[model samples]
Target: SNQSLLTQLLSGDEKFRIASFPTDLPLNGMGSDAPFEFASKQGLMTVMRHVHLVLSRLYPNRPVFMAGRSQGGVAAILYAQHYEDLAGAIAINPPHPDPELFRFTVQYLEDKANVLADLLHAPGVTLHDRSWEAYKTFTPSFDYPSMRSLSPILTLVSLGDPFNLFPQYAHALKAFTENDAKNQLYILDAGHNLWNRKSTDTYREVINLQAQFMVNQISKVRKAC
Candidate 1:
């Protein structure tokens, strides 16, 4: 029910108009018993349904861009893959639903459990089943949610994100948009931990970058019309 950490941070920039909220009751660190499927679908649909609708009504003539961090990032990318209601979408260090990702991330973490669920469990913070099951067998993985078919999204990568390094971030950014040349892949010189002071500053920079990208995308769209 609260605005996301992303919103809290981005609100500092008065130049930008922000309308950020939880992707679902399950995300936003609220925690949920939502099974694998519901966790994935609910997050994406909340944006497509509630958030987008609210923003569209508020700014009917304005192009709306969506951006999310981590799980929220996954939702943003997934929403764009299925719908064209957004002007553009940006995902920052979105960890894919891949078992290998967790397995690989273990080498850098103190907890080395190989079980996907346990490996990712954050105790009382948030996230469902550590998202391992959803990553492995979610319906989207089987039939429709192919990154290859996704519209161009600004995916920012962190070379230091243990769970999703720049190289592992490849598959997510492999897809080309209609304007192939504009599918920009930016590698930031920072880690994925946005909780600390240093990381938080980097996140601020990322938000600024996202704001600039959105302005450019909106301009291009207006020009094409």
Candidate 2:
């Protein structure tokens, strides 16, 4: 289940060399902070910087594409926005900055503190002070208009997902990229995890579609050169 959509793509396509990196944030209890800290702007930026540094050193001359799920998806979008040389970005179920959602998540965590503690069972699982500050400062939804100027973005959203606030986020992103023919927003009939269906048919179809889009974009760039 840890395998992502990008992983599926890489396995199916032999011509493309893909790299997947961890967020390296405490959000998943992998760090000192409690779960969900990685949802903050600070957490996202930290991962983005790490990704940029790695890519710069390892594949400086090669065209790079970013793709991810949930918070990782948000990071991919942000990275694509900052780097003009990126071929493109594919974000699945990304969450935008919404004050109400933030408030709701904080409240949910607070109410479920004991449950979270039991689940994570790691050191420094308490909420970090910086997370709250980052929430107030790093709202990406406010910058959607500027993001329209960045590289092409393809957003895949699931209509059945009511838990992650993705529909609104995808709608706003689609609006920003409305004028760009290269950018697209695709809606799926599943939930937050698009590949959760018992039948692999839907998952295979989505992955194939994404792979085709990425190939087309890469071909266009090569022709332009």
Best by TM-score: 2
State the lDDT of candidate 2 residue by residue for 1-225, as single tens digits: 326554554434445555655443333212344455544545565666677678878877666778876555666677667667778888776655556664554565556555554533333455445554444345434344455436778878776544344445456556755866656878777654466456487687678678776876777787898
In terms of lDDT, the poorest run of 10 residues in model 2 is 24-33
C-alpha local distance difference test of each model: 0.56, 0.60
**Per-residue lDDT of candidate 1, residues 1-225 (tens digit):** 135444453435534455655554233222455433444465556646577888789878777776777666667667767666578878776655545654554344424333434433433333344443444345224222244423457878776655555375455444433235435657676764543465577777776678677766765777888
RMSD of each: 6.8, 6.3
Q: Give the CA lDDT, 0 to 100, for residue 45 in model 2.
A: 56
The total number of steric clashes, by the backbone 3 Å criterion, in model 2 comes to: 0
User: Per-residue error at 21 for model 2, in Å?
Assistant: 3.4
Give me the displacement of residue 70 in model 2, in angstroms. 1.7
